[model samples]
Target: MKYSTVLSLTAVITGYVLADTPATCSTTGDNTPIKSGCCPRDPSKRLRRSAREIFARTDSPTCPTPKFYGDSCCTHEFAKPTLDKGTFNLQCGANGVADIVNDAVKVEIVGCDTADDLTKETCILQISSTPAGSITDTHLEISTSAWTSTKYPTKDPASWSYTSYCVKTTGVCQVPLNKIGDGASALCDKKLYIAYHTSTSDGTTSKTCTGDGTLIPGQPGSRWWEYLTLDFTCPKTCDGWCCCEKPVTPPPPPPSTQVCNIGTAFGYADGAKNLNGNPVGPAVCDTANRWGWYFATSETSLSGTLIVGAGGNDLTKGTTVGTWSATITGSDITFKYDLYDDNTNGHFDLSSVHVYASCTAPTTCAPGKFTFKDDTLTGSSDTSYTKTFSVSGGTCSTYYLIFHASVNQQIPSTGTCPTPAQ
Candidate 1:
């Protein structure tokens, strides 16, 4: 609400004085008796008018001269007039308090029949005060949800079931005397009230319901329920800066689509089956590709260096063997890695490997940050094997390496065993 300043009257004095004993006036106009009875005349023309005479004259009546209470000449007793208390009716204005001004404030239906049912319908009232102004007080009231001729328990039985009230105040509003001043006015008080009603259909069924309450003054106990009244006086003047409006948040941005690049390799190794049906390779063969050849592995080093080995048999040694190595790379949107076998000193073979690269923009092979998949082998034979491969690349955090290898046998009767079987 806007405020305007204007000159207001301070006080009004209405009455007249009397002259009885030729009083002397001081520099400041204090009436002091110069000579008692010096100007006295007939008793009927007494110098000072009696109280009755002063009361009879409505125009320019003189004020009564100061008289001592116990003076022999003055024994009149004056009684003070009594004043009547006043009552005021306050009603909710149209457009609610919002029409008062723009300010940051929250209004909600604190008491509702069913909260869930009102989720879609918000009983929220909002107000905005200018940066130069603030709402400092709020008042509320709630009437009976449904009126009943029957009396219900109430603090004030005289007003029971007829009406209920609630109020709240803050800041300057709490002060007994404070007016809305020019420039910026502070919010002081708020009052609210809700009314209840009932409906009957065909005089058979009666339904009672309560409507939303309105804010007003003079309701009982309304001063207690005002939800919030904030302090808006900023320590620093926000001359150019206005309070930010409550934000209307939009739904979160849609989930991002993910793209991946992958690459993979596989390998295997092979060796002859012993008389016990157990596969056997050289002690150094363990250092080399074995019957299960996926990647390099040593008793000392878990991940051994990749190597290519020669294959042949030492017949006198009764060892059957052959060695091979395989590697593959390609691009695909999707790829996976599975290990088929890990062998030493034998032929190495790899299943088809898949590779993929993904980018929101275009593909770039930045070192150390590229994405890719590694290979793993699960099964193998004495001379053959298989493995699974996976792809990695394109926005991947790491690249994978995969492979498989196997070995073939050379019979000593054929004299095909190389010296020491290089």
Candidate 2:
């Protein structure tokens, strides 16, 4: 948006009269009254003409005044008819008064004479609200957005000597409804003043009138033709710069769907038990790389299917083949399982290694899906192993775990696996 310097209008002359009493003189002679110029009787009314058009038509030395407002053709040499109340309307959208309160409406003033080239000049348009008999007045500034070049009084359409400006109230403009009247009601029924002025325009050299177009009484360079006063009434409610009622706000969004807490231990379900008779547990010994008995604790209940790759076969194929149990607390989970070796005639290496969980059944534990895995027990007869998982979430429920094992599984010195209930 562009902002320019503003020129203020002063010494406002209020009250509006469309035309003078009809002249009874003839149309062809110089006997026409000097104040009310000569005109043909019964002149047609021209509604909503621009100020420039009204000035030019009334000053024309013709029988029929083209843009006169009433039957009498009053020459505007002394006074030009100011814009009436219906000439301009405030365009508050379909919401009407509600739009004004919300500051969603813009007041546009078009066809305002700027008197000079826009690129070399600055123009100002102002609107003020004053009560009928009150001295308080509030002025609002409007910014110019467009310009047109045209002749003012000449009938030739090709002439471009004078500049006209188009302006509108902007987004940053707000109506102070509380400052207008008594500040207790919703209706802003007050006298409105609309004025337009250019920073460098001279009033005396621009037009041929004395009353509305002449210089203001005390202001040396100010013009009276630049202002139009009328009645302004609307429904609005505001306290200071804010509307009395607030605008409606929109609603918020929904929650997320992730199920895993990524840094805590995965716990066991209620009533989980270990079947092996080693003893209730947390039996500690050397790590799996040394020669010693280490009883893995059976704390967590296995709720999902366990796929064990024992002796080059899936030991999880039958429910009667093996029994497994596990429990987790804090950052550690201990598990142990016992599986019968099907190859009884020949000795085979127990190479069982990794454990994993998934939402569905799988033939092999994939790379990214391994929940608990250890490579130290491969090709060995170690009975106990321990590893830690880093994922955090609710306890295991409605899922499957894949466990790989080998033949001739070594048991702890006491038993194959520990029973946590014992």
After superposition, candidate 2 runs with Cα above 4 Å error? 1-300, 303-322, 330-332, 339-349, 357-364, 386-388, 392-400, 406-422
RMSD of 1: 34.8
Per-residue C-alpha lDDT of model 2 across residues 152-192, encoded as one tens digit per residue: 21222113111122222221222332332332122223333
At residue 230, give the lDDT of candidate 1.
Answer: 21
lDDT of candidates 1 onward, in order:
0.24, 0.28
Residues 374-421, model 1: lDDT tens digits: 334222322243232333333233232223222222222434333332
For every candidate in turn, the CA RMSD to the true structure comes to: 34.8, 28.6
- What is candidate 1's TM-score against the reference? 0.16
* Collision count of model 2: 10
